[model samples]
Target: MEITIWDEYYELLPRKELEKIQLNRLKRTLIRAYHNLPYYRHKLEAEGIDIHRFKTMQDLKHLPFTCKEDLRRAYPFGAIAEPLRNIVRIHSSSGSTGSATVVGYTAGDIEIWAELMARTLTGSGASEEDIVQVAFGYGLFTGGLGAHYGAERIGATVVPMSTGNTARQVQILQDFNISVLCCTPSYALYLAEVAQEQKVDWSKTRFRIGIFGAEPWSEEMRADLEQKLPIQAFDIYGLSEIIGPGVGFECQARAGLHVSEDHFIPEIINPDTGEVLPPGETGELVITTITKEGTPVIRYRTGDVSSLIPEPCACGRTLTRIKRIKARTDDMLIIRGVNVYPSQIESALLSFKELEPHYQIVITKENFMDRVDIKVEVAPEFFSDEVKTLEKLKQSIEEKLRAELNIHCHLRLMEPKSIERTSGKSNRVVDLRKKEGLT
Candidate 1:
């Protein structure tokens, strides 16, 4: 239960002092964005935002809000604040949802990112002595390099095992004696399954801590991981648009992910009205990059739903903590007038001992009504159960789903390993309404 904090001076700064730093950085970011980036300038002018008159943090409400669409519109380089000559590195989104959001970083920005990630690793109980293995993908995706730099910054022995090759990942876990692992939560579960298949002894492995993010997971998922693997799983939160994976991290307290307030300012706003909600109120997450020089966003709407915890953490960091992100506004599924989130389904499925964590939510429109069909993989032991037993289990699962989601769903029990697995973010939801010309 050792509490390790990187850059204690900044991480444990008093609330009043942190606000002063945030205000100063906010002003600098606004001035640079308004002057260098035409996109911000136009938005600021249209909203009649006066950067100089911003006396308190409350004035941030007057600034224009940025969204993914805006970043997509900016594309390649429209959002970058610094000159091309000064930009040192670039990372981008997968463009799987839309046009990719490209984020640039200056040498200073990279240093800041490394520092924030160092704090993240330290907060997650990773120390310089730990041999860290980063399983997130490299290149355009930010997770791999963001973690690589952070582990290096903290003086840890880093093994850059960038995604895929499940067998090799397990081999390295034992061969390299990796003490810390970083990857998506689903992928971690997949690795554990693979390890079991290989008959690898978890007790012999040095793996102790796992830092997972880049997709939404639930507490039930965390419990499953801890039960399956020999590690204490911690959640980390960040997006490529907001300095990759260093925006926030979980401390030893495991209460909530602490926002790196000195570097980025976070707010919760009503997704529909764009009105900022008070702390402890659930809403869309909005972030403003105060220290980012290459692409400083002004109240950028993250599309993530979470609330802020203003109370100080037992870890002793003054940074505000955000409830683990379980759903995004855009990811919420409206099925037959009921709102359903994939995580909700995952939670329900994991609650059943007969069900594996791997599942998919297939949404389609049937006769002008939305239908949710969940394909869940049964645990290996239950896969061979009698048809009657399987049917009874399926019925029980459907009843649980009905109770939890308040919506009827067709649950299909599949043999173990039937559902496809990925080394990166697992695709949990398949929405075919638009493809079926029903949207």
Candidate 2:
């Protein structure tokens, strides 16, 4: 019951048969969307879309894409194809960038999400007897519920301890002898620190596989976490817009994440133009949810930079996979186990017009320490080209970075062009830890 083989049964099926199944599902979703949802029907009608005539997947490209803006404009429950009473649960984003994208799931949709998650768990060797501790927050957000249901589906004993209760989370893992753990990779590192602080015997614990997401992580960071916790850490990818983390997960091979393409279609396309790129070429990851019953998105541009691998996986799943994400196009920065965005810094920096937007962040290493330094060019007219004025500005910027980024930043105020500015995007953080020979 653990590892149900999907590829053996369906992988060798004719490509056209798989296409037919996908087409049938797409037709059902399209009909549900066109008849029940006002936003999609009006938009499709405006575009003169003959929904009936579009029979193939390529034909789907003719329809307009659904962006986060569309969800924001509609707000909560506007995109739902089913009645409110029929929805078993809701999931949402913070809308910090714009309006929050609200998602509803039918009872069946919840079951489907769980089934995919179970596949994630067991495919990674998580067993029914394993005590699974879910460390994500439970709410309208997708992270907690998605993993909770998946762990339960695999018959693993699930502990529903939500995020931010690090002490409590650590206590439960120590008390119950939990095996499989899930959380953002950053939080996992934080929890490991607590285990060290509390003098917990990590070796005596049953902890095994770690499913981590909600932030970008590096292989170096993974090694760091594994060294502390001494367990296999995995990268699970998902977005609230196109289902949560169950879309794909890492198998033992660690080569690439095997996506549930049979349920969700994965494609690498040009971010700006939406042109489909070749398999090996790097581009944005776009997902089309073919099997989702609620709020199915079509070619939703994920804005995540990565490459696609359509070849058969060694894990016995013929599903297409993607390489590790390089970075997000948005102004996001991860510093010392925290998610910091430029807007968070911009809001802090804009408190005074004395500072200019023409600033560069220098993330350097010195004396075996990870340091974040912000080198900025203040307005020339506001401050004379003097080191004293620069020092004053430096103090101001450091306070703001601490307040906004939640991490202390060494602020260096320089004369205009002290740090070169390009007409294009400038480097925000320069990580010099490796060049200095510090891991």
RMSD of 2: 12.2
Query: Model 1, which residues run further than 4 Å from truth?
Result: none
TM-score of each: 0.99, 0.74
Error of 1 at 405 (Å): 0.8
Error (Å) of candidate 2 at residue 72 is 0.9
lDDT of 2 by residue, 302-340 (tens): 877778877776766666788866466564566676776
lDDT of 2 at 209: 82
Against the reference, the lDDT scores of all candidates come to 0.92, 0.74
Local lDDT at 193 for model 2: 64
What does candidate 1 score on TM?
0.99
Model 1, global lDDT: 0.92
